[model samples]
Target: MKRLTITTLLAVALLSGCSSKEEVIPDVPPSNLYATAQTALQSGNWTSAIEQLEALDSRYPFGAYSDQVQLDLIYAYYKSDDLALGEATIERFLRLNPDHPQADWVVYMRGLTHMAQDRSFMHDMFNINRFDRDPTPSRQAFTDFKYLLERYPESEYGADAKARMIFLKNRLANYDLATADFYVRREAWIAAINRCQQVQRLYPDTEAARESLKLEKTAYEKLNLQKEVERTEKMMKLNPAK
Candidate 1:
């Protein structure tokens, strides 16, 4: 009986080990793994690409294709809509290769990752009104792109980065205005005025600045503050709302 119990235990252990065989990673050359990752990427199989790329990165951290492998992995995460991983990967790459030649691109990608989080894909695709959403991600992305342009003034991505920065600014301004409008609708005059001023103060160059001035003046009027309303009116007259 004792021998049978021991044999049964050994058999169970062996079966468990054997059943897990499919989970084992095959011993492939790093180059081959990289090529497989590349093939997955080319096929637009982002999840597969990420799996292989992650395996390569884990198995051969300092391999010849380390830098490109990381970059491709970041892009795969982004394409797969796993933005948190994409962002974390970018931070890791930047930390590891601070003075890398492609650092600017990585920074730009980091910004894009945050931008992708600003609104859901369906929202952007359907042109939905999601301005009421939190603006933190947009703010983070704007700072990222701003740093990119400032640090890498002549980077190849300069032009496109600038365009995205402008878009982010507008999005932020819109968020502020939406919040201000919400306060106004609720008759929270002070809060509404504060949000309007915030938009104007931070984004005076944006088109939304004009709308902010309009809302600010309306808030002043609602509060029956003639002096404040007159001041806002003069400013509005100088920069009429478009």
Candidate 2:
């Protein structure tokens, strides 16, 4: 009787372990997982799409849809407003598949992610100046877009990237102008002059160029650099709208 009880207990333990193991692991096929993720993406359910894609990636890292899954994951993360994750995923994709046919799309999406993050609630809703806040993200976006234009000028997205680059350049110039204005207000003549000079040299055709020239003139006058003041005044006259 004792031997029979011990045997029954061992059988029960083995059955319990097997049941727990099966319950813990899902038996999803790779194709089904990819299809489910695609469906979620098509339905605009970005969060669900991410979850499914992530599952597929973990289970079948080298599956037929692995590359496509990574690409879709980037879009899903971006759509879900997970900007940091989206950016990281794109960088990974670029690093791994630099010559991928869709490289231009990846680069463009990365630039868009930065641009989207640069816009804040205050800037969008209250019409607050973006230059009043941090400009790092905007600068980064501008760099990304410029790189895309330089590397893939004939890309399908080249025109849009170029347009965004122009907008970002203007914004960056305005940011420098704002800094110059602040320095002028604080009577930091040299710093003000430097900021204005950056705007004039780097963003000559931008609207900020006019304000930059005006600021530079004021700074030069404050520093008693009469020659510089005259030169700036002459330049400003030559380009009245500058």
Candidate 3:
């Protein structure tokens, strides 16, 4: 009984010591914690910055630095390529601070984050076509930027969002044209024409829209639709591809 009691006490003491060491957060002032986070951010130590900022946020959520903490954390998540956490942080911020003066800026950051996720590293390194991949990120980014424009027309990010929207529009339309090209190569003229018409209907002013016209002409010719071919030829003349 004596030996068993001693062993139990030793095990309890070892467990206590391990638990004490796991309390890694410093017992310091919130100001000091925030300063440490700032230093980490300035030095591009994203993981360290996240730890310090999260500590400050948890300890003093209603303190003077609460809002800024959330913003900084979101930026840190983006820089570290922790996209899921960044998106969640942005959503929480907007949900709680819907009328914040910096709401537009937050919205802009969300759009930027989505666009960042849309880029494919393999495509960039291998010179492969990124448009062939799933475009859900691009679609989400386009929607986000569109919302930014509609909600805050005078926002500083308005012009940039508009430009990105245009690029996204072309990207989406080009994807459709690429699929249409595949159908044409397979001799599926109707499928090819359907894809071309989709591009023309939705992104009529895009460069992809002009390219779609050429595909439409080819698909019509293959289908033996002479009059439709003539119509597509006239539309191609009106909006020639550059």
- Best of the candidates, TM-score: 1
Which is the winner by lDDT between candidate 1 and candidate 2?
1
Clashes of each: 0, 1, 0
Q: How far is 113's C-alpha from truth in model 3 (Å)?
A: 0.9
Q: What lDDT is obtained when candidate 1 is compared to the true structure?
A: 0.90
lDDT of 1 by residue, 24-120 (tens): 5467999888888899999999988988898889989998999999999999999999998898899999999999999999999999999889878
Model 2 — TM-score against the truth?
A: 0.85
Q: Encode model 3's per-residue lDDT on 53-168: one tens digit a residue.
A: 98898899999999999999999999998888999999999999999999999999899899888876777789876676778998999999999999999999999999999999
TM-score of each: 0.87, 0.85, 0.87
Residue pairs in steric clash, candidate 3? none
Per-residue lDDT of 104 in model 1: 95
Question: Candidate 3: what lDDT?
Answer: 0.91
**What's the alpha carbon RMSD for model 2?**
7.2
lDDT of each residue in 1-242, candidate 2, tens digit only: 99999999999999999999666535678888788888999999998899889888888888799789999999999889899999999999999999999999999999999998888766789987768567788899989888898988889999999899899898888899999999999999999998888988999888898878888999999889999999999989986762
Evaluate residue 42 in candidate 2 and report its C-alpha lDDT on the 0 to 100 scale. Answer: 98
Q: Lowest-lDDT window of 10 residues in candidate 3? A: 127-136
The parts of candidate 3 lying over 4 Å away from their true place are 1-24
lDDT of model 1 at position 101: 95
How accurate locally is residue 115 in candidate 2, as Cα lDDT from 0 to 100? 90
Output the lDDT of residue 147, model 1: 95
